[model samples]
Target: MIVPPPLRFGVLGLGRAGVSMLPALRTHPHAVVAAAADLNPTARAQFTRDFEVPAYDSAEALCASPEVGVVYIATPHQFHAEHCLLAAANGKHIVVEKPLALTLADCDTIIDAVERAGVTLIVGHTASYNPTVGAARAIIRTGELGRLRLINFAAYTPFLYRPRRPEELDSASGGGILFNQTPHQVDASRLLGGGMLKSVRATAGVWDPGRRTEGACAALLQFDDGAAASLVYSGYDHFDSLEFRVSTEDERSLSLTSHGATRRALNEGARSPDEETAMLSAMGYGGPAMRSVGPGGMGMFQVELGLAIVSCERGDLRLVADGLIIYDDEGRRSLPLRYDRGVPGRGNVFDELRSAVVDGIRPIHDARWGKATLEACLAIQQSSKEDREVYLSHQVTVGD
Candidate 1:
């Protein structure tokens, strides 16, 4: 078998998310980080020092480089479409971070550019790549779930409390939890429900006056097929659902050990709770030196976070640290999954892109699918603002 040369990647943005993706891009079997772009001199210097790759102070320089075959855009939410267009214009394939764009119109603009350039585009909807998420989608398709009925997903994090660039605290700039975090939940819901979204009714809260973006959101979605989903998310730094689970002994042990120490330290006034959380949030930024135990004992890789539950007709599926948990009339069972540490979820985004470029296989979550998810997210905001249900066109489908 002949092994083709790795696809050379030009990374745009050096923020926390961009920096985090560097290690994976470098380690991917079919991808390599050939160049990077960021406006921050500190970031450029650090990236060059760490990766020994040419770092540019502007995205245009990186995109124009002959070494880059693919451009990975991890810029802030407001700039996604702009960066994508630049990359497409340069005749480069693209891998964009999720929430594809701030609005459906921007998504369409990006779609137009990529289609015109005849370049492959893939959105980094990492949750959709999770093996457990894939397993849930598979179970639903098997008809064992007997027609997907409801999905209940909830997440709470110290998002708002995290260190931020000014844009991150402004909703219009795509800084809030809705644009930043809810994409995962919305994509996961769409994947499991397997239908077009019909409507959404939601409520959002902005508890902190200084941070004007929404601190919490609750939404109810109705699918065309009669399936429904409810989402509850908070970024107010109050609680972490992943750390609060009680089903497994491992969770309990972690809670008693790691969490217990933090609580004790907080009570002792060694550091304020807010300070400790900010420190924790800072860890997610910076270059990618952090590593964690991967699934199925797959060694170490960057850590990702989220929690979700899919309630179908006959059973309930939950994503756990190791894999999945299903509860039904027959009780409960745990399913362990293998991890591909090179990329998010199952690490198939690069492979999918490669297939699209090399074998003409359209990606499962192509631009249309990403646009639909973005539409759903935008509808959530509209529903909250109008205090009424917002209807959707369901413009994108599974295979279109």
Candidate 2:
């Protein structure tokens, strides 16, 4: 019997997103990091020391490694296309972090290259992998949500400062909250709405002088089903927020909030018994007890890698649900009434990536989905600049 080659991986770009994969990769049974590539000497050293994997000076070297069967790209917003193209050319299955590329053109370029290469190309859209998102998808898939009419998706990042450094702050580098932050919500909206975006009308503004990009953006999206989503994204506020409320024509609603305070009380040191009770009361009882639902057990990214490994091994897309099963806590799994069963306010982009990998499917936030999100973001910027309601072209493809 010919044994299949072990799916060795090389991770390119060791920033926040890149580093998060270390724990997940270490735990995966079918895949291991053969090498890692990053430009920063300190980061490279730390990654090598942490993972005991060879460290290369550049992504090109890592992709070229004979042992590497796959490449995970976690570089800054602007470098996704080049890295994926290089890795795909080198015959490596590519896993790119979300927003596929900075622009629709870049997304198309990367997609074309990956298609030509005939290798698995998956974007790291972490939101879809979220257990709550999974449960939500399952619920929606079952038509329990019943002809969704309105989706109010909001993500607020307080202390959301755009980088002051030249390399990190440029719009070309994916600096804006609308562009960088809203893709997750966009994907979620698509998931719950069950339709393509027909058009987008947006308004945005930059409240902070230091940040050239909009600190707040609101978009009104009309879907093919006549359902509409009101998306409010704020990068600067007194509070950090992540929430999605899906309401259907059947008079039922589901709200998913992945944020900070809720996770801390649930995952970290225990609070006073009274405090715990209060937390439960505030979160609303999903059932007997308040289960913490925050992002834990595996961060969003690690979950993504794990999902990919499992899916590749399984040889089918059904693993998407499998990974979700692994992550689901009662809070995450419970229906509308059980919202408080899991910890609130925690999810990582990695979760969606791994789920897609396991299921042998790409998410709505695939290259096309990313493009639509970017289009909406760009429209917001355009509208903000022109002080007019920017209307998205109907002919645009939201995602393929």
Candidate 3:
């Protein structure tokens, strides 16, 4: 068998998103890091040292790399669209991080740019990429569960208390759960509900006086097919929803070990943006050589971002750490999934991107799909502001 040369990937941003994917990109059969770009000199230098690839200080330099066939946009929320446009203009296919952009118009701009450039664009790294989510969606479509009725999804984390950039704690700058986290819930819910969010009623909580961005939200999403999802997310550090996760792995603890330190650091005092950026670079791809020597019974990648409980006419589906559990009149059973490794927990996203780039297949989670998810997220905020359910008009179905 003849194997094609790996698609050279240029990564823009050395912060959480870009750095987290580097390890996976290094190991993927069809992908490779050709270059990277970051505004932080520390990050660029670190990336160059670790990856042995040119790490540019500006997005333009990274995008201009002749070796790059694809560009992965992992910049801050506000920079997503700009970086995407740059990559598209450079004739590189794209795999941009979640929420696509800060606004629908920005998302549309990216869509138009990529369309004009004739390059594939995928906005992801979300729960929709979970194999268990895929399995659940397939099982629901089997008609054995009857009609889909309701979905209960919730996730709690120390997002608000984590070390953050200046834009991270400000709602006006797209720093909040509605932009960063809810995209996962909304997209996954849309996929499970068969897409098309008809309307939304929601309440977004912005309770932290120290950090003025939204810290929590509870949304009721109504799909076009009449399915509904009650989605809740809280970034406050006090309560952890993962504690309630059902898993195939050791079921003893669900604590985020780093949460305490990050929360303490946040509460200690204000931190300079440069200090935080340096800290972010240290945690990213090139900063420090890191290792974890833990007892290995279950795999490290066997985890989910949030929990979901789906209700149908005849049965229910509950997502677990390793796979899924079904409850029907016949009894209970589990379906554990095993997929190819990529991006830690997000194997499907990698697969989809590969197919788009190598086989010229359009991903179900393409630009329009990402826009639909963003539209729903925006509707949640709008609904909260107006104290009324906001209707949606731009939703599209999932899949080809």
TM-scores for all candidates: the values are 0.86, 0.68, 0.92
Between candidates 1 and 3, which one is better according to lDDT? 3
Task: Please rank every candidate by lDDT, starting with the best.
Answer: 3, 1, 2
RMSD of 2: 12.2
Q: Per-residue CA lDDT of candidate 3, range 293-390, in tens?
A: 12222232222245678899999988876678899999999877665554434445667888888888878888889899999999999999999999
Candidate number that wins on TM-score, 1 or 2 = 1
Question: Which candidate number would show the highest lDDT if scored against the true structure?
Answer: 3
lDDT of 1 at 308: 68
List runs of model 1 lying over 4 Å from the truth. Answer: 244-249, 252-307, 341-346
**Positional deviation of residue 358's Cα in model 2 after best superposition, in angstroms:** 7.9
Point out where model 2 deviates above 4 Å. 1-6, 162-164, 242-333, 336-365, 387-400
Worst ten in a row by lDDT for model 2: 308-317
**Candidate 1: worst 10 consecutive residues by lDDT?**
296-305
Model 2, C-alpha of 169: deviation from truth (Å)? 2.7
Model 3 lowest lDDT segment of ten: 292-301
Q: Write the per-residue lDDT of candidate 1 for residues 1-400, one digit (tens) a residue.
A: 8877888988898766675576667667888889899876766877788778899988899889999999988877788899999999999999999978888888889999999999999998456666677778888888886778888877776667655566776888887878877787788788777748899999989898867898789999899989998888887765666563445664555543332343344345424446543443343324343333223332211122245678887888877756678898899998767656464463566777888887798887878889988888889989999999999984466663
What lDDT does each candidate get? Answer: 0.75, 0.55, 0.80
